[model samples]
Target: MAKGKEVRLTIVLECTTCVRNGGNVNKASTGISRYITQKNRHNTPNRLELRKFCPYCYKHTIHGEIKK
Candidate 1:
């Protein structure tokens, strides 16, 4: 069985550009690109965001934390 809570947590980061441009019906989203990383729950309780490369966007964009 797992403990009540965990210190280090695994999270998913999704491209914000992909989400904002989701209305385009012609080009089907390659699906929002995601990056998996770990964070210390006690240190940073807020959602994390990072600039990362989005292949679909063809540029670096803000990737925000999303629920798994």
Candidate 2:
């Protein structure tokens, strides 16, 4: 019941637009637009990026991985 490390890791994806404008999910000024998902550390050593929907923006935008 032991292992070196987990292959999959939890990551947070935030909207690039909001991030640029210093908008965070916790901040009440804007609702929120982030996705919590798992990723394979081995497969994706680099930062991950995805197109997700942002209610604040009311459209799809690029969500990039940020420092945890």
Candidate 3:
């Protein structure tokens, strides 16, 4: 078997508040804000959650890693 290239994995962080409050007509949102970050597969093999700033929400919220 050929050796595979060792590449670091990256994930997207999305705001939970923006997704939940997206269905309202009166709400104003350009869209859900996302942040890209990298993680070491050997160090952490599970999903990651981070507190990030959401322009739409105007506050820091728990951003969860989402599948591509």
Which is better, 2 or 3, measured by lDDT? 2
Worst ten in a row by lDDT for model 2:
23-32
Model 3 ranges off by over 4 Å: 1-7, 23-26
Q: Write the per-residue lDDT of candidate 1 for residues 1-68, one digit (tens) a residue.
A: 47648899999998888888783422754667789999999999999999999877778989999999
Give a tens-digit lDDT track for model 3, residues 1-68.
Answer: 44334446877888887778772313655578789999777787798889999887788988989996
Q: Any runs in candidate 2 off by more than 4 Å, and if so which?
A: 1-4, 24-32
For each candidate, give its TM-score against the true structure: 0.82, 0.78, 0.77
> How much lDDT does candidate 1 score?
0.84
Q: What does candidate 2's lDDT look like per residue over 1-68, in tens digits?
A: 35648889889998998877777544556755789999999999999999999887778999998777
Query: TM-score of predicted model 2?
Result: 0.78
Residue pair clashes in candidate 3:
none
What TM value does model 1 have?
0.82
Which model, 1 or 2, shows the larger lDDT? 1
In candidate 3 the C-alpha lDDT for residue 10 amounts to 74
